[model samples]
Target: MNRLTLISLQVLVAVVVLVFWHIASTTTLIGNPKTISFFFAEPLAVGKRMVQWFMEGSIWYHLGITLTEAALAFIIGSLGGVIIGFWFARKPLLAAVFDPYVKAANALPRVVLAPIFALWLGLGIWSKVALGVTLVFFIVFFNVYQGVKEVSPAVLSNARMLGMNERQLLRHVYMPSALSWMFSSLHTSVGFAVVGAVVGEYLGSAAGLGYLIHEAESVFDVTGVFAGMFVLMGFVILVDWLVTLVENRLLVWRPKTSVISNR
Candidate 1:
């Protein structure tokens, strides 16, 4: 489908869902109306709470805090991943020495590290950023490692025959391949970055959307919780779209597939 048609359908689907949700919560269209409304909260109520939050202007501070944490984590984790991944891929001996340790670290449940991070970094944004970094780093690292290692041997030989130095080979061949892989994992890493921040906040924090949701949940305010969730979803979608734009721009030479009209 065309872009406009796709967007229209997406909006229509959301409208239909909201309408059904309203009906189910307001009437006996599904389970017990009281239970449904109590558990899910009315979509209208969630929207109202979201509006109130925006109008109160307190949410901006929380948004800033969360975004800062996520942004820092993304940049740091990505850089570390790219550097280490390239190093390991280039020096198989070094990789062999650390391979088991790296795998073990990656295998560890990041949630367990939250308490340690909190102890070290305190309950401030740094703790959350640390958590997010751990989550994002491994993703980019693995992708880059695989990308560099998978470079075509024939192409590498050709470059060597052409007298390309190590740096030249990296710039022209390895970088392009690794970048493609790194970008592929970045979209996923963004969500994990957000999750790390939010989960850290959820575990312990005085501010952030996660804190807001936790507070609402503590008070049994389902509407507030849902509003916080919707806000988080909205931000994630916006960030993901920004990533897509950057990816498209940077990978312009990556080639594109043609789309022919069905009609």
Candidate 2:
């Protein structure tokens, strides 16, 4: 679809959802309106609460903390994932040796690690960053590894015949091959980075959007809870938009037959 058409469809979907939500929460559409409102909160009320939060400026500090944790996690986790993925893909024996261990690590439930991270790092941003890194690392690592492994054999042979050394091949061939895959996971990585930060904050923290939600939940303030969630969704969308701009710039030459990204 064209950009305008796609956006129009998206807006239509949002309107439908909001209308349904308003009917369910503010009127006797689904069942008792009071009970529904208690559970879900009126959409208008939540929107107003969101506006109040931004107007009062209390959310900026918490937003900043969450942003800091996510930024650190995305940077650290992506770097580690790319470097390690390259190493493993280039070294079969090394990969074989660590394959099971890597699988085991990835299989572990990340939510289970939140409290442990908090205990080890204290109830601070670092704990949140650590959790976020765990969430981001596996995604980028698998993509990068597959991108390198899927490099065309014919291209490799030609490069080898042209007298390129391993280091030169890696710089010119492997890195470029992996770039598309790396960028393809940008949105997912950004979302998970935010998730990790928020989950960590929700579990235990002095500040963050997640903390705001948790506080609201404790008081049975459904409007506040929904407002906090809406803020988080907007925050994530903003970050994803920035990531997309970077990806579009870097992959301006992405080809139709590129094996690096499914796109």
Candidate 3:
């Protein structure tokens, strides 16, 4: 289908969902209005609360904190992943020695680490950044490791024939190849970075969108909870969009494939 039609359908789907939700919560379409409102929250009320938070400029502080945590996690985790991944990929004996420990660490549930981090780092942003880094690190690491390992022997041979040394080979071959894999995994890593920050904040923090949601939940303010969730969803989408833009710019050397319509 065409892009315009696709967008129209997407918008229509959202509209339909909102209308259904509004009817179900505001009327007896699904259940008693009061009961529905108590559980699901009125969409209009959620929207109004979100607007009020934005209008009063209260949301920006919490949003900024969350964003800061996510950014730090993304940067630190990705760099560590890339560096370690390159080292392990180049040294087979070292990779084999540490492989099991890496897997064990990666397999550990990240949520359980939140309280431990809070204990170690306190309730400050660094705790959240640490949580997010754990989530992002493994993803980028595995991707870069695989990318470097998958570099074609033929390509290496050809480069060596051109008199490329180890450093030259890394600059011209390994870095570029590993970067493609890193970028491919970044979309997922970025979301996890946000998730880690929010979850850490939710577990224990004075401020953040997750803290807002937790506070709302404590008071049974379903609308506030939903508003916080909506804000988080929007923030993740915005971050993902920015990641996509950077990915496209950096991966421009890669080829693009287009489908041809038989009709």
Candidate 4:
């Protein structure tokens, strides 16, 4: 669909949903309408609260801290994943030996590690960053590792026949083969990074959008909670869009495939 058409559809859907929600909450048609205020605050009220935070409130400090923790975690995790993934990819023996260990680490629920991170890094940005990094690292690592492993044997032979050295092979062949997967993991990792940072804040810490939301919940301020949530969602969408832009730039040589037809 054209951009205008898509936007119009989205607006229409949103309006329909809001009307339905308002009716359900104001009437007894759905039963126990009193619970609606507890579960689903009206969109208009949520929007107004969001505007309050956006225009007159001091939400920027919290946003800044959350963004800092997420960004730091993303960078650290992606770098570590790439290096370790590349190392294991080039050394099958090591990959085999460490596969179980890696799986075990990834399988462990990361939330359980929050307290340890808080203990080591304290209830600061570092703790949140550590949590986020733990969430992001394994995702990127596995994708990169699989991407490298999936490289064509024929392509490898061709490069070798052309007298390419290990360094050249890695730079021109292995790395390129894994770039798509790496970017894919990165897109997913962005959300995980945000989750890690926010959940860490939820668990402990005085700053961050997560903390703001937590505080609001503690006070039964549903509108405030929704406002904080909307702000975080906005940031996540912005970062995801930025990642798509970077991916497009890097993968420009790759052909595009559109699933949607004009008709």
lDDT of 2 by residue, 1-263 (tens): 69999999999999999999999987776899999998889999999998998899999999999999999999999999999999999999999999999999999989999999999999989999999999899999998999899999999899999999999999888998886788888888888999999999999999998899999999999999999999998998888889878887887887645624463
Instruction: List candidate 3 stretches off by more than 4 Å.
Output: 257-263
Model 3 poorest 10 in a row by lDDT: 254-263
Per residue, candidate 4 scores C-alpha lDDT tens digits across 233-260 of 8999998999878877876766576211
**Candidate 2, TM-score vs. the true structure?**
0.92
TM-score rank order: 3, 1, 2, 4
Superposing all C-alpha atoms, what RMSD in Å does each candidate have to the true structure?
3.3, 2.1, 3.0, 3.0
TM-scores, all candidates, are 0.93, 0.92, 0.96, 0.91
Pairs in steric clash, model 2: none
Q: Best candidate per TM-score, number?
A: 3
Q: Lowest summed lDDT over 10 consecutive residues: which window, candidate 1?
A: 254-263
Q: lDDT for every model?
A: 0.91, 0.91, 0.93, 0.87
**Which is better, 1 or 4, measured by TM-score?**
1
